[model samples]
Target: MKTIDPINTTNPNGFKNQASAALEDTNLQTALQRAKSGFIEKRKKAIHLVDDFEHLKTQAQQAKQSALDNLNHHLALFEKNVVASGGAVHRAKTPAELNQIVLKICQQQNAKLVTKGKSMVSEETHLNAFLEKHGISTAETDLGEYIIQLAKEKPSHIIAPAVHKTRQQVAELFKHNHELGERDLEEIRALVDEARAMLRKAFLLADVGITGANLLVADTGSVAIVTNEGNGDLTATLPKTHIVTASIEKVVANMEDAGKILQVLGRSATGQAMSTYTSFFNGPRRTEDLDGPSAFHVVILDNGRSDILNSKYKDMMRCIKCGACLNHCPVYGAVGGHAYGDVYPGPMGSVLTPLMKGIEQATPLPNASTFCGRCEEVCPMSIPLPELLRQLRNDQATKGLAPKLQSMALGIYGWLARKPRLFQLTMGMFGRVVKLFKVSHILPQETPAPDAPDTFVQQWKKSKQGHSENE
Candidate 1:
């Protein structure tokens, strides 16, 4: 794996520059175009087949809201249940704390190598890099994760980590990394077979396996996970000790609630009616079980989520890690996940990265969108993403985080807008300037002048008047 400074990978202020470069990168653009169509059409078709998709989303949202509202109560119940099932629960308040807990577990087991399923929480804490630094080898079992792991890159998308890599790129990566002599590398089947062959050994040799939970059922103390590739099952069952790292927001009341979210999760994420493997495990292998872990541990991390619960961003907690928002985001399709430079990318990432990484550092992320409501439209949780983004922008401005000149300009504009006559005069002058620039070819011919009679403000006022009349 290539060396990466996980701490400095994201640049909230440099997002514009990163996005600009990504827009110009031909290979990335091609990959994004290829993925964009399939995800959108598949999700759309899947939803069309369900008559109660909206109702399911609403039920899922209510369940998450209920869990979060009484988080302490549910967490205690979940812990009690896990203990009853013979699994230990560990609590971590920060990423460093979470890493240390996992490290201690590995050390106690004398684990030299670890196998991992696709865990976004692990990515958030840079677990792989941390483990490697401590002389422990970790292998990513998911095909996309394995590719990015070999590339030493963080996951760009939540579910599909290596969506940015084309098959040709994967073949090249395999050629560079693996010592295969003139193999069939062009076909995806060949690539999967190659990855499977290589990872089979890692799975067998690993002393511990780690995975993320889709939802933690409080009633049963079981961690439910959905995977199309079944790597998660292998990661959880094949090793001596299994550790599940999950966010606090993943806890739900019961299996019934899990079923409600599961209805939309597969449809919104991969367009499948149900994932290939939807498995639940409460404890280590029982005496009757043939093959399973001897020990089970659950590490729940609060990080910044507790604060978000009482704040305006609480709706974001309803997110199920389904990549529907990413698939529908136009900006995401154009530049791909790396542009955001975080574990979670696309519309969800834009809001989340800032909250998790600090708005001061990730300032550009909230403003990266075109304010299209497609993210909210396709979200399985029905999170009001656009409204949340607007709130973030408002928070940013309230903190005086904007550049001095930009703040001054906005202040001036605010004052002028209060005086309609002056505001109209300024608009007329700006339009004239744009028309002059157009004639001189300074501005693009396609650009619309601000002086147009049907400017946005005018249209808004007209619509407002019509609404008032109807009322």
Candidate 2:
């Protein structure tokens, strides 16, 4: 994979330093623990209530795979339907192309400020930077995205972008940024209301609103948005022109297929009956409707996804960003999102960043996980995350991106393992030898200073002693 202005993933010390600093942030730790537990409980209860949860998973997986297999055929159909519904479809092959298409529309419409919902594709393309460069002001309307944007931080969690922010942290952010008086804003609802009031003005005055679709239906050319906050509705509706930035992979065959995915999406993400607002837009506003945008534009970005569609990494395109994987990820729970230093994070990020960006630029990410398959179990799509991760690891090795030490070490082990006698001898001698070390570990990569085994080797030796005596 090719990368633009890549960062050095070769510096092991740099990643260690960054991850260490993240681990030390007590506020982030507390917030993550609280959010993770709360979300897990909510999801478990929601899953129990949904009678067809398992059924939905199967249906959703099949639908997604089928859609992916015939994406080209469906995409063309979607463009036709979009035009038929009075919306323009713009095809962009790269991030720069997508940015320019949106900016050109903004220029034609004389748009000064663009109100935006949480669109990861936009963030991926550095759309905010691009817009600002073109003399257009852009603000994130999603509450979590808004908070992170003000703090100049990337989202750690895909669903709850600001899940790492404590109430106290929020108060400070609001006080420092909004100057919302000296009095405390004790209620979460009050904080939400405050954000709503501010966003209302932006919504009313903005010429164009931008959002990312949860899925796009090829049969009808509809962009489906599932949100609990209801901000998606306002952002996409209140503006004169609504622009959607989505990739080709997010399309499904029809609304029925979309429902299958949506059913599992919230159940696996935050545990809700359904997202409070599940809005579907079949183009721009119709002439008959009293409300809705007059001009609607859909910008489909390919980026690096087309290449993925043709390779082993294509399974990743099935991701709906439900964030279930991140929610249960131990490493993500430890360091939060900032440590990833990219728009996406956690186990999903591990498999994705490398494929989307480049293997060398994101080598540290794949190793960040513990090979825990909790992500796969919770994933409604059943993407087999651990298997894919191992594939990525293999790819890393083939590309000469893995650590040289690890490559050499595994090679030696494999050489011995091929000969049963040699392997057993090595293991016996190794077990006997490690008894003298003050500390023991599988490798140098383990955390907490590689703790010493207090009595493991001795216990094994004693067991052997007992067995010999019995014999």
Candidate 3:
């Protein structure tokens, strides 16, 4: 088995360097271009199919908000029900604690092999690396997860973890990893087939399985996960021990609440009415049950989410992990997820990373946005992503974490804004300098600085004069 390296989580400050590198990588650019359009178009079509998608969004938002308002009570109830159903619930206040809890369970089961479904919480905790270090072999069963596992890379997109890999790149990775001689992998179907074939063995041989919950139904203590492939079901049922790693915010009131979110989740995520497999696990298998795990445990990780719940940015907790924000974000589409240098990426990440990590550690992430508002517009839960990002920027300035040059420039602009005439004069002079130096190249490509003969003030004044003369 190939050793998997721990994901680099200490580099939120290095976003600019990573973004620059991402721009220069041809393979990454190719992968990103192919994916961005498909996601956008598919979502458009899926949303069109729904008669009242906005109503569904509102319902989902309300459900999440209600759960959050009564978070402690819901969590307690969830735990109570889990124990009632013969499953155990463990709480971890930190990533290390979560890993330790999972490790203890694996040890208790004497697990030699673990098969995993897609779990962003596990990714945030870096569970695979932690478990592997303790002499356990883990296999990723989700096709995208499996690809990135073989390549030893972090997920570049939330929904499509291996979205940054082109078919050609994936073929190369499979060729280098798989022992099968000269198999056809040029097509997308072939790549998926190869992964399925590889993972089938892992599913049968694994002693334990770990999966993530899209929603944790507090009413019945059920772990709900949706996947395109049926791997999540296999991961949860085939093994003797099943572990679910989830964040505390994932809890919803009941199955009805879960359904409300599920309505928008699938449409907003992959442009389907629902994922191919929407499986819910109540607990371990009963004597009367047909097929399920023998031992079931749910590990809920805080990892700064509790702090977020009390903060002004609590609206972020309402997120359903749909990749709509990422798909619609210009910055994310341009640079891809890896450039953010964190577990989460794109517009949501810009607000989230700084709040979870320190502002000083991820100052660039907040500033990465153009404040286009597309992320907020497309977000199913209506998270004010751009507003949240601006607030983060404000926090950065408050802490003096923003660059000295930026602060000085903003200070000068603030002073000029108080005096209208001086502000116009300064802007006029700035416009001339821009035209003279041909500095439009320094501006964003989408909204380049214009080389117009007159500034807006000059144009307005001339128009007023012309109107006065006509009168």
Top lDDT model = 3
Q: Could you arrange the candidates by lDDT from highest to lowest? A: 3, 1, 2
Worst 10 residues of 1 by lDDT: 1-10
Which scores better on lDDT, 1 or 3? 3
Q: On residues 1-471, what C-alpha lDDT tens digit does candidate 1 reach at each position?
A: 222232365455677777887777777777889999999999989999998888888888888888888888888899999998889999999999999999999999999999999899998888888898998899999999999988877777888988888899999999999998888898999999999999999999999999999999999999999998899999999999999999999999989988888898999999988999999988988888898999999999988988888788999999999999999999999878887877778889888888887888788888888998999999988899988888888888999887789889999999998998788778766756767666556455666644453545766788899999999
- On residues 145-263, what C-alpha lDDT tens digit does candidate 3 reach at each position? 99999988989888899998889989999999999998788798998888888899999999999999999999899999999999999999999999999999999999999999999
* Model 1 TM-score (2 dp): 0.92
Off by over 4 Å in 2: 1-14, 440-471
RMSD of each: 5.2, 5.3, 3.7
Best candidate (score: TM-score): 3
Q: Once superposed on the true structure, which residue ranges of model 1 sit more than 4 Å away at CA?
A: 1-10, 439-471
- Scanning candidate 3 in windows of ten residues, the lowest lDDT window is 1-10
What is the Cα-based lDDT of residue 96 in candidate 2? 95
Question: Model 3 — TM-score against the truth?
Answer: 0.93
Clashing residue pairs found in predicted model 1: none
Model 2: per-residue Cα lDDT over 312-422, one tens digit each: 888888999899888888888887776776767888888888888788877778777788788888888888888888998898899898889999999999999898667
